[model samples]
Target: MGAVTGDQTVDQTVVVAVDGGGSKTDAVAVRLDGSVVSRARAGGSSPQIEGLTRSVEVVDALVREVAGVAPLAGVDLFLSGLDFPAEEEAYRQAIADLPWAPGALLDNDLFAVLRAGTSAEAAVAVICGTGINAVGLGHGGTRVRFPAVGAISGDWGGGGGLGSEALWHAARHVDGRGPATALTEGICRVLDVPSVPELIADLHFGRRSQGDLRLLAPEVFRASDAGDAVAGALVDRQADEVAALVTACVRRLDLAGEPFPVVLGGSVLQAGHRRLEDRIAARVHDVAPHAELHHLRVPPVVGAVLRALERAGADGGALARAEAELVGTAHAALVGGVAR
Candidate 1:
C-alpha cells in the first residue's frame, strides 16, 4: 500500500518490507529516497500455525500501525519467513484480497536478509532466536533448508532449545542422573521460585510455562561463563548443532563451489554472548571447513527493506535513499529487528 495524504495518491511509490518471526513482527515502510517514513510491530501470526485470518490480522495490525504514522497504501511488500509454498499462498491470497492491497511479494525471510547483506547467490544464513532455521542458497535462486521441527523436537539451536536443555540439566541433576552444577541454583534464582517443583507448578498454572522457560537461557550462559561444567557443555553442544546445520545444508545441497558465505543471527548468538558466538563460529568452521562464516550485525528488517526496494523498482537515487533510511530504522526504529 502506498502512503495516503487524505488523497487518492500516496506520498510516493514505496517499498514496504516486513519480517515476521515466531516471537514478533517488525515492518518498515519507506519512500523512494529511503527516508524514514513509518515503523511498527504486531504479534506473530505466521500461517504455519496461526490460521489465515489470525495471520493476516496481525500483519494488518502492524501495517495499519505504520500506515497511521505514514501511508503504505501503494508500496510493495517484501516479507520474510514465508517459506512453505502453502503458507506463502495463504498469505499472498489474503493480501491480494485486501482492499488496502499494496502489491505484496513473499519469499523465505532468509532470502531477504541474505540480499540485504550481500549479493551472494551461494550463501547460508541462520536465525537463532526463539527457534533456529538455516538456509542454503545456490546460483540461480536455489535454496536448501534445515527445517525447524518446532519445540520439544526442534534441533539444538535457538533460545528455546537451549533454554529447554538448561532446564533438562537442572532436572536431571536432581534425579541423580546428571552431574551437579551451579545451573540448578541459577535456574531457581532466574525463575524466582523456591524450588524446581514450584517452578514446574508455575509453568503449569496460570499464564506461565512454555514462554517463560526460554527466560532461563541467559542465566544458563552466565553459569557457563563462571565455569559450570553442565552449563558449558550444554552451550558447547548447541553450538556444535548449529555448525552441523550449516554443514548439512552444504553437503546435502552439493554446493560444489568453494566455501559459501555463511551468516548467523538469533537470540542465542546476538544476546551479548560473544564468547558463545565465537565458540559456535569456531565449531562451524570445523564442520564446514570450506565455508566462510560472516559475523553479520545487520538487522533482518534492513534486508526486508532492501528486497522491497528492489521489488518496487524504486532504485538509483531513490533506492539508495530508501535503503539508507530503512537501515537506520532497522538500527533504531524497531526492537529485535533481525534480517527479514
Candidate 2:
C-alpha cells in the first residue's frame, strides 16, 4: 500500500508501528506525512516468554490503544523471540487476523536496530540487551542471523548471562573455590543480601526469583570500572561475544571487504561503558576492516515507523520527518510522561 499524499486527506492513511522486546513494547500511530497521531507503551511481549497468544494480545492491545479512532492503513511489528520461520509465519497469520489493519510487516527486533542505526542498503546489527542477537543484510537481499536462543544456541554475553556469571564467580569466591573479587560484595550490595550464602539460600528457597539475577549485571560493570580482576574479565568476555557476533554476520554475508554499517544497540551496549565499547570496536576492526560501527541513539520503535513508511512508498522527506518527530515524541514520553 502506498502512502496517501498532498491532495488526499491525512486521516486516509495511518500506520501503527510497534517494537516489541523482552522488557517492553512501544507502539506509535502516524499519518502519511509523518505526523504522530498517538503512541503507547506496555510490558514485554516476547512470544517465547509470554507465549504466542499472550504476546499477540499485548501487542494488539497497544495497537488499539494507539490507533484509537483512526483507520489504520497498515501495521508493522519488529519483535523479539521469533527465532525460526515457523514462529514468524505463525505470528504473521495471527496478526493478519487482527481487524486493526489490512496488512502487516513483521521481523525480528534486531532489524529495528539496523534500520534505526543506518540507512545503508547493506548492514549488520548486534543487539546485546537482556539477551544477545544479530542480523545482517547483504548484497542481493542476502540475510544472516543467529538462533539466539541462549546457551543452547551457542550464544552468550547478554546482561542475563553476565549477571549469572557474576553470581557464579561470587559464589565460588565465597566458597573458597575461586579468587576473591569485588563482585561478591557488589552482588550482595545490589541484592541487599548480607552474604553470598544467604543470597543463594534466598534463590534456592524461592525468596528471590532467578530473573532477579539480571540486576547484578550493572554491578559487574561497576566492579570492572573499579578495577576488579574478575569483573574486568567478565566485561572482556562480553566484548568478545559481541564482536564475535558481528564478525560472523559480516563473514556470512560476505560484507567483510565492502563498507557496511554495524549497528550496536540494546541496554548493555548503549550503557556508555567505555571499556566494553572500546574492546568491541577493536575486536570488530580486526576482522571487518571496512565495517563502520554505529550505536543506536533513538528508540528502535522509530525504525518500525520508518519501515512502514518505506512500505508505503514514502519519500526521503517524509521518512526524515517521521524519524525526527518520533525521536522527539520518545524523549517527551521519557521525561514528561506524555505518551505512556
Candidate 3:
C-alpha cells in the first residue's frame, strides 16, 4: 500500500528513522515488511546542548551505523534541543549528505512523542527528561511549539530543573533563607557529606561536578513519596509546570473540550512517579477537561518510523504492522539503548 511511484510497492520501500535527544540518539533502518534492517545509538546530539558541529558529528555517526550503504525510500528525524527555526535549518543543512537527505524531513522530538503516543489527527505531547519541551499538532496541519531553551524561553520542568530546585531549597534551608524541611538533610544524606556548608564548598570550588546534581532528581521523588514537604512542593511545582505547557498547547491548537490525547514522554514522566502523575493529570484536567492522558511506552524512534512511513505514503495497515514490529524490537534494544 505504498505510494504508486512508477508502480513501486510497499514491500520495496525502505526507511531510515532517527530520534535525537539531549541524552542520546536512536537510529533505525526499517523495511516495508515491518522488519528492522539495522539499529544504532550514540551520545547526545542536540544543538541546544552541544554546539552544531558536535551535534552533527553525533547524529551522523549513528545514522551511518544504521544506514550504511542502504537504499532508502524515505528518512525522518525527530530531534530535541532545537529551539527555533534557524536551529532546525542549521541541523538540516549539516546532515544533508546522508543518502536520503534530499527526501528527508526533520521535526522537533516532541512531535515524535505525539506520534508515538497516539494515532489521533490532533494531539499534544510533553517530554520531561533531561530537559522539558512540548508540541501540538492539530487537524489540518496546525502546529504549536515552544522555544524550550531554558528560563530565557520561559520554559522549565525537566529532571535537570527539578534537581536544581531540590538543591536550591536545601541550600536555602541551610542558610535560613527558606523553610526547614527534609530536603536539607535528605540531600546531605544522599551526598554522604556531613553538612550543607561542606557540600556547598565542594560544589562551588568544582570539587564536585555540578552536572552530577541531576542524580538528586530521584532522591527528590523518593523524598516526596516519603511525605517530605519540600520535596513534595517541588514535585507539585513540576506537575504544574508540565500541565501548563500541555494546557497552552491544547488551547493554542483549539483542542479544548475534545477527547484528544496529551502524551507524556521522557524518563521523569514515564517513571510513573505516582504523585507527580496524579498531580499532572489533575492539573491538565482542570484546564483541558476532556484531554486524555497517555504515557509513551515505546521508544521515540517508533515515532520516527511512523513519520518515515507517512512520507513513503504507506497505507494505515502498513503503518500498524511497522509500528508493531518496531515496538517488539524496541523492547530488546532498550536493554542496551541509552535512555535520558
Candidate 4:
C-alpha cells in the first residue's frame, strides 16, 4: 500500500522493489495482484560501496528489466540501500528524472527496519554485514549511527571483518610470526593443499574467489567449538566488538532501562554465528540491564516492503490488513508460482 503515484495510470502496473546491497543488487517487479511478473539483478550499487556512476548503472538496468516485462512507462519503487544525505539526494534526483512514473522515495535503509517494528517509542538495529552500522529510532525519526569507518578503524564484526581476521591469523601462523593455529592447517586441509604455501599461491594467483574466504567463517566457528584457542578468540573478539557498538547506540539515544527493541541483522550476526549472538546479548545485558534484544528470524525484504506500506500512511489496523493480504499473497505465490 504505497503512496498512490500521481494519477494512477493504466501504465502503472509494475511495482519495483530493490534490496540494493554492497555485493549485489536484487530487484523484483510484481503486478497489482502480487504476482511475480519479472526479476533482475545488477552489480553492487550501494553509494558507500560503489560510486554514483556505477550505482546509477545498476539502477538503470533494474528499471529497464522491470519495464521490459510490464511495458509500463511508469513504476512504483521501494528501495533500501546505503543511505547518507548526499547519496539520498543523488538517488532521488536520478530516479525522479527517470520519466518512469510515480517517481521514487529515498530514505535511510535502517529507517525501514525501524518501521518494521511494532514498537512506537524506540527500536535499535545493528547490521553487521559487509560493514557495521547501528541505528536507533527514538520515536519520530530520531536516530544515531555508529559510522563503520572501515576496517582500519576497528570495525571487525561483519562477514568481511571475520574473513579478514581469519586470513590475518592464518598468514601470521604460516609465516611463524604467531603460533600455529588450527585454522592454518584446517584451511589447508579444506583446499586439498599440502601446506599453507599452496593455499597462499591459490589465493594470490586469483584461483579463489572472494566468497572462498567468506566461507571460512563457519569453519572458524566450528574449530572454536572444538577447543582451538585462536579460533575461539577471533569469534570472541567479534561478539565483543558488536556488543560495544550496540550498547553505544542504545545509551546515546537514552533508550536505557526499558524493554526497548534491540534488533540484529546481517548474516554474520544471524547465520554465520549463533553463539556469537548469545555472547553479544550477554555483553549487552551487562551494560544495559533493562534492554530487551530481539533477533529477526525472517527475510529482511518482507520488513522492507512493510516499511514502504507504513510510510504510505497505512498504520495500525490498515497495516495489519495489508500484512494479512501480502503474507497470504506471498504464500500463494511461493506455492504455485515458478520455482524461485
On lDDT, the candidate that comes out on top is 2
| lDDT (tens digit, per residue) of candidate 1 on 1-340 | 4555776655554446777766677887777566657888777655664666777787777766665544443543434446567767767778786655645566666665566555566777776777677788776777786446665445665677777788778877877888897888888888787877667667678646676777888887898889898888878877777777777777776763576677776677666676667777777666566777655576677677766766656545555565556555444432222322
Order by TM-score, highest first: 2, 3, 1, 4
Summarize candidate 2's per-residue lDDT along 18-78 as a digit string, tens digits.
9999889999998877778888999999998789999999999999999887767788899
Write down the TM-score for model 2.
0.92
Question: Over the stretch 1-340, how does candidate 4's per-residue lDDT look in tens digits?
Answer: 2335687643335455555666766665544434445667777677666776777778778867765645442343333344456656767676665655354555555554444443455777777666666677675667786445576555666666666677778889888898778888777766566877777777789986655666577767888888888899988998888788778877787766776767776667767466687898899998778777665544444454444444444434533443344455443333211111
Q: Evaluate residue 269 in candidate 3 and report its C-alpha lDDT on the 0 to 100 scale.
A: 93
Model 2 regions lying over 4 Å from their true place: 1-9, 329-340
Which of candidates 3 and 4 reaches a greater lDDT?
Answer: 3
lDDT of each: 0.67, 0.85, 0.80, 0.62
Q: Relative to the unseen true structure, what is the Cα RMSD of model 2?
A: 4.7
What does candidate 3's lDDT look like per residue over 160-227, in tens digits? 89877888898889888998878778778887889878988999999996666676788899989998
Residue pairs in clash, model 3: none
Question: Which of candidates 2 and 4 reaches a greater TM-score?
Answer: 2
Give stretches of model 1 more than 4 Å off.
Answer: 1-11, 48-51, 68-83, 151-154, 205-207, 256-259, 272-275, 287-290, 328-340
Could you tell me every candidate's TM-score relative to the true structure? 0.83, 0.92, 0.88, 0.77
Lowest summed lDDT across 10 adjacent residues in model 4 is found at: 331-340
Kindly report which residue stretches of model 3 are placed more than 4 angstroms away from their true locations once superposed. 1-13, 98-100, 189-195, 329-340
**Residue 229: error of model 2 in Å?**
0.5
**In candidate 3, how many Å is residue 97 off?**
4.0
RMSD of 4: 6.1
The TM-score of candidate 1 is 0.83
